[model samples]
Target chain A: MPHITIESGKLTDEQKRTLVERLTAVSSEVMKIPPEFYSITIHEIDDASYGIGGKCIDLVKQEYMEKHS
Target chain B: MPHITIESGKLTDEQKRTLVERLTAVSSEVMKIPPEFYSITIHEIDDASYGIGGKCIDLVKQEYMEKHS
Candidate 1:
């Protein structure tokens, strides 16, 4: 059984559903398993809770937004 | 990189923090890596969203509760 957990910043419900469907489609194709056999969960985390390079993801996102926007 | 994603039913903020700390401690002990080097994220999910054996988790929980209560 293939179970996938995706942890990322906030996403709309639609986005989550789409991700699940697309991921299942590709994964099933590659693994030679039926799409229904795969289980995927979307774990939406607040950016503040995730850290990289000792800085919170929210802060990092803000910086990235400033640079690109 | 030792990144872990935990997907489960809703948990309080305190519970989430405790889980992160405890998981890092145990994982580091087993992997022989420093605790600070591990990254963990908890994805709290609504029971209605997760499926188990063709039934949503909420429905399963309801059945379990009815039987146990």
Candidate 2:
């Protein structure tokens, strides 16, 4: 019984469902548990709410996109 | 930029705050990152919504509590 939680930027409902399905499948395979035995929760966060490398995700994304694009 | 996501049974606001603070402190110590660079998200889940060992958390808790008490 694995409880998987993912926190990241917002995603569509379809994306959320797909993620849950994929995570469940992979976790079940890796852990030798049935997919139905797994619990997955997705938390949609704002870019400003998440931080990385001492900067908020929004800033990081902006910089990265600027550099890459 | 470590994004920490915690999924478990419901916790109080105070508990959530304490958890975030403690996790940030320890993660910063171990990861050599500033506390402000860490992102922590806590998801309060109902026992029924979580599963382990093919059993829902509510059932697991009830059985465990009964056995222990």
For all predicted structures, in order, the TM-scores are 0.52, 0.51
Worst 10-residue lDDT window, candidate 2 chain B: B12-21
Highest lDDT among the candidates is held by which one? 1
For A1-69, candidate 2 gives per-residue lDDT tens digits of 679877778899999989998989988998899888899887785655444533455666888999999
- The residue-by-residue lDDT of candidate 1 on A4-54, one tens digit each, is 988787899999889999999999999999998999987667865664433
Per-residue lDDT value at A25 in model 1: 98
lDDT of 1 by residue, B1-69 (tens): 588777788776556656666777788889888776877776667999989899999999899999999
Residue B39 of model 2 has an lDDT of 80
Q: At residue A23, give the lDDT of candidate 2.
A: 83
